[model samples]
Target: MYALENEGGIKKVKKLDQFLQDNLNDLRDRGLYNEIDPVEGPNGPVIKISGKELINLSSNNYLGLATNDHLKEIAKHAIDQYGVGAGAVRTINGTMDLHVKLEEKLAEFKGTEAAIAYQSGFNCNMAAISGVMDKNDAILSDELNHASIIDGIRLSKAKVIRYNHSDMDDLRAKAKEAAESGLYNKVMVITDGVFSMDGDLAELPEIVEIAKEFNLITYVDDAHGSGVMGKGAGTVKHFGLSKEIDFQIGTLSKAIGVVGGYVAGSKDLIDWLKVRSRPFLFSTALPPGDTAAITAAVQMIMDSTELHDQLWENGRYLKEGLLKLGFDIGKSETPITPCIIGEEKLTQQFSKRLREEGVYAKSIVFPTVPQGTGRVRNMPMATHTKEMLDQALAVYEKVGKELSIIN
Candidate 1:
């Protein structure tokens, strides 16, 4: 409890502000306070903020399509034709032609029989999980699955069993146990196509085999993998398991470079989701501009692999540069790189120092990861040039050595 200040013999402490301030101070003291740095313009490889330009490595704009001129033009055209808002929910009159086109394009892109669009990737997870799984079901999820997945599982009211991250044996054993228990009317296995934090890929082939052995539904949330994997189709296609997986979830926001999400699966599955998913039934639909832009972006991705190649090349360059500088760049199979720093405060400080030195990488600390394994995650994009990466590397070395994180 906080006491009133002596100077305010008149009881000067405002109760609401005092409570919030106290809580905020506690977060700061614990080194868990998040510092927001807003970008002034587009989320390109280099971003400007507060009159300073930085080599940005903190965005999910993996393909640089977020700022692509072509996508912008397409979006403007959509707005001209259909306006900004969708005008209603999907279950109502909001199923615009662009929305239908986007879903069709997504189905074709993902090689699924049909697809249904949602307002966001997070919404897709929430809707897809709850719409399919219920109290009679059990979900076997990866321990490192995204927050959206965890929330979706909770919303589903299904029994959630978290197996070890990327551990095939653990998953196999869990699936077997869950199947044998016979407590569930249906069992589903959900996982991220690519784990966002470590940038490691999920073992989809092994998971698919286990799912088949146990007669489980397989769902892949390829939010981070779209436009960055399988030459831009996604991780399911990357593993050549497109036909086998039951559900493929993706986002238009990430590599697609716009907004909204979708679930691509059998026509029956999508029809079920469209009717039963809460977001589609209750929430407003995705706007015409976003729907059209996403459709265009997916087409661009399916059309060529130039952006994909450049993204991987940039990832390799950043990793190699960090490794040569004696930074503990973790074993990331993708462009999502993390420089591990042990302590929470130190990791936050390292991120702050990087920003001060013209780089913008954010810190990922407890309990997002293990309490002690704090890190600064760097996401290199296809738009970044070699010179920009070189600049970022130099800044990293400076800050890392300043904090005694690297020799």
Candidate 2:
């Protein structure tokens, strides 16, 4: 506990500012402090940061729909009809017709019996995980699961058994131990359908098989997989195991090009979340424009795979270009490319050099990934033209040679 002397003779805990300054200084000294760069305009294939235009590669806008003309129009129309905000929390007066419709479309899109939406993807994890699992339960979570999932499990107060990343054997061993331990009331296995940092797909088929063997509850957060896999449905649909998984989690902000998160699952599960999830019950509903745009985005994805295909094409082009330049592009099953640079400060320097040379891929370091595996993560969007990718590649080559990261 930190305390400071008050103006009078009283002792007070007024060292918060000192604490923050010390921690911030430590991060800066260690090269772990992240500096936020504000984009000057719309976040698209090309972005203006500090008045300089660069090929944007740090965004999660996989489909490039965030700045789509049609979606923008729909969002404007929604604002006209319903104003900017959802007046109250869902349990109060906030459950608008658009909310109902969006949930319906989400259920249809995810191939689930029902769905519930939350304010954000992070909140969905916080709400859903704690809503279902309690202290008596045990969760066998993938070691590389998203930070949101980790925090959600912590909130649940469940016994968290971390399985090695994408290791089915480890998962099975842990699942069996937890399920037959006779201490837990229930056992659950949760994983990200697509690990965001490394861009690897989870082995859902094996996980589903193991879950069935032990009657484990299965949860897949497909925030990155949805709209990019399974003809734009999700990873669950990709593996043809929609009916087998217990929770199908996704976000509207990423490929969907809007804002919000949802859990699509059995009707009972959704119903339970609606009432039990703290965020859904306590926070205001998603605003009207975002909800409408999200619905439109899902419809566009279901209507065609044009954007999805283009995204993959750009991803492959960028990946090939980086690999050809002798950069250590990791084995990414998706478009999320990581140009591996070994040290944290050097990785940050590499990213800084890339930006200076007109690319905007961000460096991801320790705490986001393990130490010594720092890299610049590139997210190629659907709208990135061939010329844009070539330019980015040229910049990468120059920076790589300058840093002696490649031959």
Candidate 3:
């Protein structure tokens, strides 16, 4: 026990105190300490942070619809009609018409027979995997799969065999072994549609081919690809394999610029999830406003590819700019540009200087990524004006040169 003078002889357990203090101190010393910046007002390409206006490259607001006027009006109208809360879990009076509409819209947007919604993209993965998998099942997962998928696989009590990231040969060999082993009743192959860290796409066509060859159930968590690919349908549609893939998970929070997640697939699969998915059965449904807002946003994406095209154009522009400046922007096939700075402390310092220079991109290091592969992941949006990007590039060049990240 340790006594604090200010506590007037109250004794605190030293062991518990030491554990938290030691971990926190170690995190700070290792440049792994994450200081959360509070953004004032709505999230857009540019945002106000601590009263300073910065070009925001950190948010997941891809299509700039987080502050869209149409979505705002729709959300307001839905709140006016349905109030704020969902009142209870989806199985208990929480399944409102708005939820039904959102699911239907998601199914249509994803070109699937049916769809199911959850509280978040993470919850969607947790629910979908465990709902269909169990102790006797086996999952052949990608090494670079999202954290949510990893957790869900772990929860299902399934044997997880991780294949190399986007390595089709490794996938084929593992799928063959898992299929022939006779050790499990079912086998599934799961991958992220887009790898968030490197901004690379999953080899979905090859993955689908392997799934069919091995008679494996295919699951893709398209959290980063929903509104950014195939005119906003998803990676499945992007590859024209909508009917081939089994479980297609997505988030309304990223490209859709809203909050929530979903799984779109065959009617039987979705129906089964509706009944067995813990989040859908036990957690409260999405707020009425979010449900309606997501539906409207999906419909807008379906109506045209205007926003999608803009997003790509900006992505290309930013990538080209960063490359020309000689920053080690990694091989990203999407808008997620990672300026790889190999040292942990310099990476954090670079992000800090960028913030001071009126850019708000955050530094990513450690367990989120690897130790030496530290980088600043920039997410440019559809709403970024050319002038804004030019300013950002100038700031980037200045800081990049100062840190010797570029000559």
Candidate 4:
């Protein structure tokens, strides 16, 4: 039994408390517990935590627009005009002009006829997948799809068939099997345009061909790919399969350096989602400030490739430096580099040592990746200078040598 203290006295623990305590204790014991460090100021290439400044490589601010003066000014201007909140759910008068404009801009950005915005990328998946799919439908998901995709599929009550990650043959076989089964009414194929952990691009062209052969609906969550790939248009655009795909999901929080998610597709699809997607129907709309800022950020990406090119340049520099230092960066095709450490405890220790040496790359362990494939995922931003990258690489080299992770 455990005891807890309140304002007046101590009380015996409830069953819930015991369960929580047991699980948390187990996680700590096994080195699976994640300790979150709060940044003291703005989230940028360099950040301060616990009064120490560190070169930040864990943020998803790909193009570094999160702290861009222009975006900040836009957000501030929006806040001044719209005040603090949207006042109610979207269905109940919260769909302001800013929201509409953002959706329109998103559709234009994604090369779709229309789009619908959600509070977050995760929520977008939940609303979108469940809105269109049901128990009668079957979802063919990649084995390495994001957690949000998994939850969304679960919420839809669909029969999930996970194909091996990036294995086109496996995908084709499953697609054939599901299409011929006659057990489901709709079969949707879902994949992350860029797998977050491994930083690999999805085999969308092959997936599209398989989908065409099977008449399956294709859904690509390009959260990480948008603002970083396809010359800042995303993975679908990168492959020039924008018109061929069905649902294109993206997050404003990542490359756009704003907050929210959207599903860009045909006008009919957006109309259907607007009417049927529960999050769109029930949840409050994105704040006016964020909506306006997101639109501006999208426009910024569409306007120039300067930031995108710089980001790629920085990514290549970092990856090449790490490779030269003999670090095992797993099969990454994007800027997301994972320095694989193999064990959870050691991976966490490696991250801690990197922090102490003035870099802030976080360790991702089991449940996020696989048990033995733990890594410190490094996300290089457009704002990171050559100097910052060099500093981070030096720290990585020092830590790698000390931990005996690299020769």
Candidate 5:
């Protein structure tokens, strides 16, 4: 083993150590460096971070339900009945009745034949994509699919063909080529219902039409679209094409304000995942408290669109205010708005300035997005008041002017 103080009589570190240093250096050079700040309070539109109260614009708690009283009460009751941990994988002794109840609730919420739960939205991608496709199959994936989906596809041992983001012509060409090659046993076309980076929606209806033409198995990762779109169900419901899309993947972590993932599809697909998906088989099921909380969240989403409506109202108000303030709110239709800042350094500076002004917007730089496309990603929660939005807009205006990002 190499000694820390001296290695081969040299004071320098090894090549492996250089790798991390080099990567971090590159990040710093490009102004993409990230720093973790401790959140001192609950997750809401406004939170106390490092003792400063800032309007939180970086969280995925879309409906502000993460800290809801009702959900908390349900979780506490479940903990009393079922304890804290699952203790084993679902296939072993971890599958509780609560798990079944949540899965059933999800199916009802998604209006699908069946649904199976995983530990996260990321896990859902890994489990579903890898479970379905193998080395002999080919996957037609959107260029901007989530990192989890990319890793999942890599694990599948499938030939991945990247299509231009939401380009139906490109998707059709790739799908046709894959199908005509006949070298693969299955063809799966996957896309995100809402691109997280840009917030522009996927052309699902057109993609579905192309899927029909190419006999491709369709997959929609609605991680950012669910609960906000589809009338609080999902993008599939938004497009009125739920029956046409084969696999519907969503996150409970985001809109549901809980921790887990699920796949809504045909009963056969759910059955196959329950049996073969590595995450499903290897990981402990969600705890009873999370399961019960998730069930309440889903039922709340299904029964009333209050949260969804409020979220949209907040989104619109924020976007309009930013635009009026001469800030470039990018091509976003959903609550996931990004105020585009040209250079990565300035973007980071802008975010820092916003934080100093009591607004907790985070800067996203290259690698997470393309260079020269850095942004301050703001997700306005349903619980945000008009007063809060107005205050955030004022901060953005001040920061924008200070940085010369706006006149």
Candidate 6:
């Protein structure tokens, strides 16, 4: 069936195909369309893309564990013992010993009663939030919460009320409204512990206080916060308010340098997810190697704060250097820095110019953010060397002046 652009329009259109062309053309015309390139080498601060080595700030390898020899060795050893995939979903005979161990380590690291792993951080949101609250519940989401959350909440059939980003007052107001609406059996306040794009942290302390005052269920997606904040535990631990939050969602991908996500909460919560979370019940379990590698990474994070310290040092160094060069680095408290460019086209051009000049920071624009708040996000990994950062800063300075983004 042909899809009509508008009910009043006489023209019928190939909805999927026409939709893609229209969107792509619009993006390209605005200089916001990007073509993905494969990484040829390790995901270090420098990566080989299209046979050219570039100073890479585009990856999410926060602690540099993605390419660390220690994690590699552990994963290899696990593979030798367990032989790749678990071959089925967790419930249907894919729950390996390694899976249980990983969950145990994750629970210990997060200081939660129990933990349940999923295929990805995205799926964790899908699984956990949907498993807990359904059509009868209300979700008070932060305006800038990750897309996974928006989708997961949508899937749950819950009434989603969005509050202004990190505005505690707005959150409190929304909570009061949702609570008093008396239209739902449960009320949840959800936010990203560290907003990935802005690099700003959630007001967890205030959120916890609000949750306590309103008797709301609290959920913090710590995808960016897990290995970066709170001595490598998360934002909840960073604020010393772990016990106040009900559901803590984290990724094994970014800082843990592996692939997977988890929800840490009361034992009952995890139990509910196991039975009801579709992803966990239908998707294949994490391979032994990934599970073991994650376990090792978590242990390393808990055993010492060295990686976390290094990451912050690198972040501060880059932030200070960029700021000194007269660039608007935005208000970022974490290592995820964004060089805000007020216009979408300029931001995309700036990113392209940087890539040409040997830095690989990606540009975010338009719908990803607001209409005018486009930026190039720079993620500094713990393993970035002084020389690497210095080189990148020099390139940035040169490009900034050429593009008139700085003096």
lDDT of 6 at 116: 96
Expressed as tens digits, the lDDT of each residue in 1-407 for candidate 1 is 45566664755666877889999998799788887878899999989999999999999999999999999999999999999999999888998888888889999999999999988999999999999999999999999999999999999999999999999999999999999998999999999999888899999999999999999999999999999999999999999999999999998899998888889999999999988999889999999998888999999999999999999999999999999999887779989999989789999999989999999999998778887888999999999999999999999889888889989
Better of 2 and 6 by TM-score: 2
Candidate 4 similarity to native, TM-score: 0.97
What is the lDDT, from 0 to 100, of the residue 26 in candidate 3?
Answer: 99
Error of 6 at 43 (Å): 0.9
Per model, state how many residue pairs clash. Answer: 0, 0, 0, 0, 0, 0
Scanning candidate 4 in windows of ten residues, the lowest lDDT window is: 1-10
Model 2, poorest ten-residue lDDT window? 9-18
> Which tens-of-lDDT digit does each residue in 122-229 have in candidate 6?
999999888889999999999999999999999999998999999988989889988888898999999999999989999998999899888899999999999899
Pairs in steric clash, model 6: none
Highest lDDT scorer: 4
Candidate 2 Cα lDDT to native: 0.94
Give per-residue CA lDDT, model 5, range 323-344, as digits (tens). Answer: 8888888788788899999799
Query: Scored by CA lDDT, what does every candidate get?
Result: 0.92, 0.94, 0.92, 0.94, 0.91, 0.92
| Runs of candidate 3 exceeding 4 Å displacement | 1-12
Q: Judged by lDDT against the true structure, how good is candidate 6?
A: 0.92
How high is the lDDT of residue 58 in model 6? Answer: 83
- For model 3, the local distance difference test gives 0.92
Q: Estimate each model's TM-score.
A: 0.95, 0.97, 0.97, 0.97, 0.97, 0.95
In candidate 2, list every pair of residues with a backbone clash: none
Off by over 4 Å in 2: 1-14
Q: For residues 1-407, what per-residue lDDT tens digits would candidate 4 score against the true structure?
A: 66777778867688798999999999998889999898999999999999999999999999999999998889899999997789888888998999889888988999999999999999999999999999999999999999999999999999999999999999999999999999999999999999999899999999999999999999999999999999999999999999998999999899999898999999999999989999998888898888888999999999999999999999999999999999889899999998989999999999999999999999999889988999999999999999999999999989999999998
Q: Measured by TM-score, how close is model 6 to the native structure?
A: 0.95
